[model samples]
Target: MTHSTDSNQTLFERAKALIPGGVNSPVRAFRAVGGTPRFIQRAQGAYMWDANGRRYIDYIGSWGPMILGHGHPAVLEAVQKAALEGFSFGAPTEREVELAEEIIRHVPSMEMIRLVSSGTEAGMSAIRLARGATGRAKIIKFNGCYHGHADSLLVKAGSGLATFGHATSAGVPPEVVQHTLVLEYNDVAQLEEAFALHGKDVACVIMEPIAGNMNFVRAGVPFMRRARELCTQHGALLVIDEVMTGFRVALGGAQSLYAQQIPGFRPDLTVLGKVIGGGMPLAAFGGPRAIMEQLAPLGPVYQAGTLSGNPVATACGLATLREIARPGFYEALAARTRALTDGLTGAAQAAGVDFCADSEGGMFGFFLLPRLPQNYPEVLTTDGARFNRLFHGLLDGGVYIAPALYEAGFVSAAHSAQDVADTVALAREVFGKL
Candidate 1:
């Protein structure tokens, strides 16, 4: 294969002149890997074609919405049919109600739900609802959990628990994040201490139950159980953000998994996105009737979007959900994902490389280390330079993974056993070179 600077270089150069960092999203620029981004022309069933017509196995899955894979026949048909009727009505629609009912039915924790246009909207609204219901101001969140760029949730860890959080981004005012407490993930002791000190004034504790942005580190079972207990004891709501793991992890989302692991455990509010939209721009937040009633025209706390429950988006989501509910959908999907991760792990081991990997359902991540990392700090201990080499090697071998090591990878139902085998073979070759 000849490496040419014609198409990709030309497109990137033109893009940089119009878009900041030559990409709509920062990480997509391949900044972490130090290369020109591959401009994708089309995607279908576990493969994507670049502008140069080069094909590669796609593992990003549009950051998790394409669980059934790009251009799924049913989803595409639903979206197309809905499009003929109309797009956004800004009024009530039967499809929206049906989609909401479907989600509430699967996620028992949600007694009522409100649609939103994006995960950030759902998360931000959930926080507002929590505050309105509790009549409290403070909220606690975990570090390294990317819950969107909401100002209040954008704070990094401060010097101490009692100290106010420092803004992680430039524009976010320090005062805005002062009441937002940032704590380390998997640190049960700190969680308890924070609750003990400020439990009275706290509105909620929001977290990504399974932190995917930090490469799929999960909240320790004990930590998760204890967090729920303390929130209830403190009169604070437990808000589970499942934007990435929602339907992708399980039919009912992360909360369902938690319920099985911890008896009598359920979040007060759950935020959902990704697979629910089926590659469209849609998201939602829901909870018990009493708490959810506090939002919008029902109560003082206000949240609304013009595109909320757009008919096409709802149709796509409904179709995707219905398909996943089919018999053996999850079983087959999980098996395929397991095959890919297991095969890669085995190949790396054979190549005499230190690799640790973990997966749940269709989402997975791996580290260039011997054991799985328990927290963000531990995850940072990975050899990033080595990872960059591996990433480029795999790309050159016609496989596409996440550009950054901190992001988790996805395996859609469209991926075949052959795709998994080929990916493992490529990884083996990459590991040998490393």
Candidate 2:
């Protein structure tokens, strides 16, 4: 309970000796921001305490999983009861079926689902299913839209449209990504060109409804509509990567929002994670029954995980889903998120600091640019030095957001009006200095 002010630094130093870069996750190292990552000891609704016992208003929300915020009473009870009953069964349970039913009920696009342990696993499995069902070898992705670290997906855009993407990661070789084509996000012309070139051989086109990793640039409505049309025309599956937006953005995820804009729109395969697991390690991908049945004993595409449906993770996810399903949950969460962004925008305007922001449901993003960015190249234009100052300023003032500029921030149901007000007030001060 008692620790020195430098406890976080001390722990980081010790961990560096044992763990690579002293972090299990790359961003957690704060490499982009150039600071020691806070060693979190514990978290409670809308707040987290670090190793030095410093309490900060948590806006990250465990990178968009804690929608109802950390340790809700109902979620805690479900998890505790499930834990008492058992952990992983290495088999099926009633609760797993119940959770699947719940998700399908809300996300109509997913007629069936296969649960996994993380977003990466869900995305990887979805691509495989697409390839298997369609009997196609090529896949298409957009720049800055992260599906996972899957080898084929770990690719960057080539210099020209004709060439496929090159491997972004070291271990991922050229041949691995040869079938992967990466195009500029929200660029309808380029998308059409790609489909025109490789339509017949394309298995699927995967994308985030809102590219959260690129700091929340929306996939333009025209762009999304074209994607759906092209995929259908080409006999390629449309995979919506809603790992960050599922349940966090709305009951049906970001796809629901897009469907409203483009009537009767739906993805062929949907990848879900984050809030679905309620801060636990659980994710899933699903589609029509015929496509889903293509896996395992039913079909040729083989994928398996020992901890696919861990009892505790499903229990936590089910509990979280039930809570967010409540009436007015998202309406209230959206208002809070808007408040945070609006306040930041007003503060930046008053201080003459170039800034803009956008939000959807509980998820939000901001940039130190005069206008909101629409693509990865535009996102790169954000002032990194200024952002680092603002990040540290907020952290010092006991408000924590994502350490990296390119990541989205989250607002939870647990965040009070006062919490948003405090954050805005602190941000105003920081903006003046900037």
Clashes of each: 0, 0
Candidate 2 lDDT over residue span 166-282, tens digit each: 327678778999999998899999989998899999999999999888778999999999999999999999999999999988899999999999999999999999998999999
Which residue pairs in candidate 1 collide? none
> In candidate 2, which residue pairs clash?
none
Q: What would the per-residue lDDT of candidate 1 be over residues 303-392, giving only the tens digit for each residue? A: 989999999999999999998988888889989998988998999899899998888889998999999988767877888889999999
Clashes of 1: 0
**How displaced is residue 259 in candidate 2, in Å?**
1.1
Model 1, position 281: C-alpha lDDT score:
91
